[model samples]
Target: MALIGIARLASESELLEAKSRVTYFEIAARRILNRTKPNMPFQWTINPYRGCEFGCKYCYARYTHEYMELDVQDFEDKIYAKPAAADRVRLELRRIDRKDHIAIGTATDPYQPAERRFGRTRSILEAFARERGRHLGITTKSDLIVRDLELLREIARANVLSINITITTLDEKLARLMEPRAPRPALRLKAVRQLAQAGLVVGVFPNPIMPLLTDSERALDRLARRARDAGAQYFGAGPLFLMPCAQKVLLPWLEDNFPALALDYRKLFEHSAYLGSGAKRILRARVEKIRDRYGLNSGPLEYRPELWLGEEQASFELRD
Candidate 1:
């Protein structure tokens, strides 16, 4: 097939390795830092890899692969690693304002399974560690992040760093079904505890809280309580939003797993990617109540690192 732009680059990428059904390719980085749209909490975003290996059924990021003209179903099967990630990030940081928040792993999990091999995420962090006064945030569903604890501590010393670990459910069976290749919930919580213990501003997010599946008060409360017990500084959650790419995967999985909810999911996400305002309000109330019960902040704790070189502390608003 004729390919253009990113697709062409992807097609020509050097084959790195393949395991099971997933293939890893090494692609050169053109740009590592991206500007977020206006009104977003963060000013910039960085995704070290083109595809996530976790293959979460409800992942909205599956559409990202479409930009390369690849089928959404191949989102997990083909992983693209940027070999020049560290150097690119270092170069891009020079153009960014120190006060603006930079979020890593907004579209792809920086610490995805492929990171163990490519270390692209670690490379980015290494670059961040050399800079001072920048507000940085990282979100991931993998416990492998703990492997870079020392590097994270170095970054935290000079930069305002917040880490968010996403743990959808404590139920191993359900998590296996939802996020087949991601780290187990307990492992993710352990990472949270370690990061918190290391004095990093860390939080737990039960993101994409599946309606009629994992959004019940009981389920959310359990997650919040466990997060608190693990020493997490904050807790947050958002209901699932299914774009077309996600619907193609999640809806069918729902039918095969929770047959009763499949039809409702199709109807709920038919028009928009977001849940209705009423549903969102209810979900917010539920998560807020759970946070209150667990004595957890709603987001990252207000913190200023001692080595902060910014004119003033950077305020990062919790989004989603």
Candidate 2:
């Protein structure tokens, strides 16, 4: 069947099921490793699943469902798990040079609740464990990642691995309002501590920093301090970007909860998804100061494994 036909069937099947608000569909993915757009920090990314269940109100990836001719709401309700993801990843890695970075969960949370049943993320990690001298990064808000600590450690031993735990706010109430179904802020913090304790490089990301909500100096500072206390090695944040698909969901939620900010948001994001440069600079400076005070790096640190250095040097010499 065509991709759109598959998506339609997946959406319709959920209507017949009497249990659960979310539905899972297994699909054969032609390719798992994706090349990042030009100018992105990472060269490649792997999303073991399509669609996320956490249902964060400000999720920017809602546009993904559009490609399948599904409604934006389907991005959260219908989850697609890729079969043979690990095998495909292993083959794809052969085409990727050791120096290129492969980031997991760039679009969907690889460790989201679906992972408990699918185990695609874990299988992908198993594949990575067999490789050497590759740059790997995984980002997620779920604490489920701890389930594969040993596998992660094995991969880290040979490859440069960085795990990013995204924590938007330390305020539990605010978090619940923004990221309704995601693991709580406290749980995420605990995950950060545990990951770091396991001798893994872990960082905290406060991405899509909502204006008038999580953008205050005090809010960012408090989050940074808590992350530091949890043994996070770095803290990074970016102002919220509300693409049209995201605005459709986020705007209504904002109007209901934060009436005053709703108008401002529409005005701010009226022309584009990105915040103005002035707004971005202010948030960046605030986050940087907090990061410095907490003795945390600005972002996840990258390492070059010894085995890859030889290849890197050879490429450089060839260029020279």
Candidate 3:
């Protein structure tokens, strides 16, 4: 790991102890826009915030915190907002054709608690609102999105804007444990309601479909129904993808709280990145049935050897 100033660069360690509050500034040198793969329907993506404040117990994005010289456990409590992000967006946009598709918060929740102060994600959305023939996707668990209803509506009128409200489990108690710092599940559902009322195509992502955790067939079915009632276009879901740093915190949480499922999780992921082809096929088939029953049919992601050998496939089940 390298450090310029006091910023700690991430190292290839297996565990993360802690981090600091000192913020850092860096420009994202993104080139391509829309991306396509066998795993996901959309190809292009943009992640405004790096370390998420939500601190989801099973968050795979915790590895991203390592890049900043931090561990996955400290990823939630400590944050680093991008500097001059709006201007940087303008600069990046000026260089590319504005007609491409872009997805935000793919790696981290853009409207996390820190967003109330930084507002960089909101600013970037404002920039995209003025763009024509452009396609954009937003995945968040925050109701702060309701603040940009007018702008999002405007963008949807001219381009493509699909907002995916991620709800791993409908059980609020489980939600609190899984996403301690994130917005309440009810508020997130409200955000979906408000966005749909404004005529934007909304969806729900009951993702990284934690096996034996939040993957209760009835629980998932209920979530799909809730989103559908809120006027969501569809619902997408999959299985868990664990990362080393994330396991530092998440595995312990699992052992302490859901001890019954701990061994099952090990069987699913300890030996390899995936839960075996047969297991995934069964789970996907189950999800298909749940979505069919509740009408939460959306799309999914890709995981191929050419693009994502081992680590890449881990990201495919983002639940990051």
Candidate 4:
């Protein structure tokens, strides 16, 4: 049996050596439940897999490993495919009285590279189709989502289904280093376009917008315009956070890549890894204003609207 931990990285060049290979396994979960109203949007959720493969350097989901008593495991290379996720979700839905809605890939990307090898996402969607929930949302940085378009259309016809494609930068050089294993930004942008054309409520999540990096006013304006033109119905953005474990791993990567700015990151993150409430307010206000300026706002924006449902949350490094 495989131990519970992240697979070790070989070398910088070795890490970039691409092969379609992936590993998968079963993770017996404790429970599956619906979202009990009182939030920003939906109520039902599902996670077909744990850990991700997109390998984005600044991913905030790294803290998810804490539940398993693991840390700084890259959140991507560490694999955990819940083979029985669909069956478990189905069994639990029967016990609830109300029509439940959910957010998938909230803790892990359901459409990661592992899904392609394991076909777990397919099984989960089919399960959803059988006795579809009321509302469902999926967030990811993969173009793999395009593969399930037909399945999504069948369920989205009646229920609430939304796809949020997370895109932080359109710059290829930035994306290559940021999300080494993930598809290029253009591909995901194309996926958003294709998904929206199918009449699904597609949105662009310019999330974890780093402090000095892609958080620039110009970066936001450019991406918002592209998303809008490509058919994104809404836009959501937030500041990048330097959660504890993530800081340890990501700060070094920053130092290696942008040596001059490493010191700035130390100072910006000095106040707090997470943005202070005042900082959040000011930044949100500015992002909203920019979204409005670019016609990218779909509705009112809310930040950290509520605590995640007993899920592990991670933060990313920020530059001053």
Candidate 5:
């Protein structure tokens, strides 16, 4: 079949590595930074890789693979790394204003297994470290981020940097079942502690709070408490939203694991991707109460790095 756009590039990508069912490819990216919608919390977005290996059943990004003319399931099996990532970001930095917020790993985990071999995420971070003023954030479920502690510190010193570590539940068995290939809960928390100790702004997000499964007050409270104990400065969570692509994978997994909640889930997502207003309000109240009890901030910390050299003198309320 004839290919175009990302599909064409994916087809021509060089084979990097392959192990078992997972294969890695290196694709040249035309640009590194992308502008986000006006309503989004951040102004810019970046993803060092095209797919993630930590096959979370509820991942909404699976549809991105469809852009390559591949099956949504290929989102986990076929990973694409962008080489010369540092150079690309350095060149693109001039196009955007210094005040814009740049969020890395919006669509794909920057530190996924592919990053271990390709070092694309690290290269990008190194590029950011050289810049003096830019708002930056990273979200991931991997403890591998701790590997770049000093590098992250360098970036944090000169920029407003926030690190969001997503931990759905502290329950090991539940985490394993929900995010099959992700690191264990304890390891992720440990990374949080270590990063926080090094003076980086860190927070815990129990995102996609699975309804009927992990949305109980008890579950959220315990997670918030642990996050505070691990040195997290902020705690937040949002209810789950399922697009058709995610429902295709998650619905079957749900039926097999929690047969009792299968019907409830179908009815909940039948009408919309987001939870209803009443349910969302209740969940928000629960999370807010938990955050207050744990003495955690409700959102990203408004911090200005002491070493920042930019003339733009303003504190930032970093989000997204």
Candidate 6:
């Protein structure tokens, strides 16, 4: 088959039923590693799946589905699982320098409900367990990651691995409204506690902090306190940036749930996706104070592997 169009590609995908609400499509993958832009913290990223089932109203990654000529809604309703992901990732890792950082789940939740059935993320982790001296980070909102605890610990022994559990709020009701299909806030907190107890570097990320929803000092402070109590070593937050795709879903959601603030959100993001400088400064200052009070690091520490062969020696050997 030529795979001429998105429809053809989709039709060719092998469908697997995981749950009544979620469907998984197996697709052939050309590559697994993606080089990151300069501004991103990591050099490379790997997403074993495309489309997240969590269906977060404020999700920024919805734009990804547009690349495949699919409706934005497909980003949640239709999930794509890459076949041979573990083998592809293993081969791809050989091309990347071990010193470069690889971040998993940057675009999609690798441990979404589909993962339980497909086990693609687990396969990738098993491959990574065989490697050494690599800086790797995985982020998810699901407690299902606990299923891979032993494998993660094994990878941590030889590689620098950090697990980031994203908890948007401590309130279950608020979280359900924001991220309707994600695991409960308490479950994520428990995952953080378990990962920390296992001696794994664990952190809490409250990203896309919705203005007037989760950006309050008291809200963030309470979240940080809970994270600290759960044994998380770091706490980080970023204000929400509503791109066009996100706005399509989030605007209506705001109107239905927080009608009074809906217009404010529209006006704020009408011209630009990013929040204003003043708003960012206020949030940063608030987070800083909370982190300071909780004795939590601002972000995960960069892991740099020791260099056994000096650069000069390697260059000379290559020249020879």
Model 1 TM-score, 2 decimals: 0.91
* Best by the TM-score measure: 5
Which residue pairs collide in model 1, if any? none
Across residues 192-214, which tens digit of lDDT does each residue of candidate 2 receive?
99999999999999886889988
Query: What ranges in model 4 sit over 4 Å off?
Result: 1-23, 32-44, 97-100, 298-306, 312-320
Across 4-45, the per-residue lDDT of candidate 1 in tens digits comes to: 656667778899998889999987555677666555677777
Give the C-alpha miss distance for residue 38 in model 4, angstroms: 6.7
Candidate 1 Cα misplacement greater than 4 A, ranges: 301-320
Q: Write the per-residue lDDT of candidate 4 for residues 190-259, one digit (tens) a residue.
A: 9999999999889898877877788777888888889998999788887776766567767888899988
Q: Report, for every candidate in turn, its global Cα lDDT versus the true structure.
A: 0.82, 0.79, 0.68, 0.69, 0.82, 0.81
Off by over 4 Å in 6: 1-8, 301-320
Error of model 5, residue 307, in angstroms: 32
Model 3 Cα lDDT, one tens digit per residue, 29-117 = 23212243545445556666557778888777776666555656667755655443555666666666555556777667888866776
Instruction: Flag regions of model 2 displaced more than 4 Å.
Output: 1-19, 301-320
Worst 10 residues of 4 by lDDT: 7-16
- Model 4 backbone overlap count: 6
Candidate 1 or 2, higher lDDT?
A: 1
- How close is every model to the real structure, measured as TM-score? 0.91, 0.89, 0.83, 0.82, 0.92, 0.90
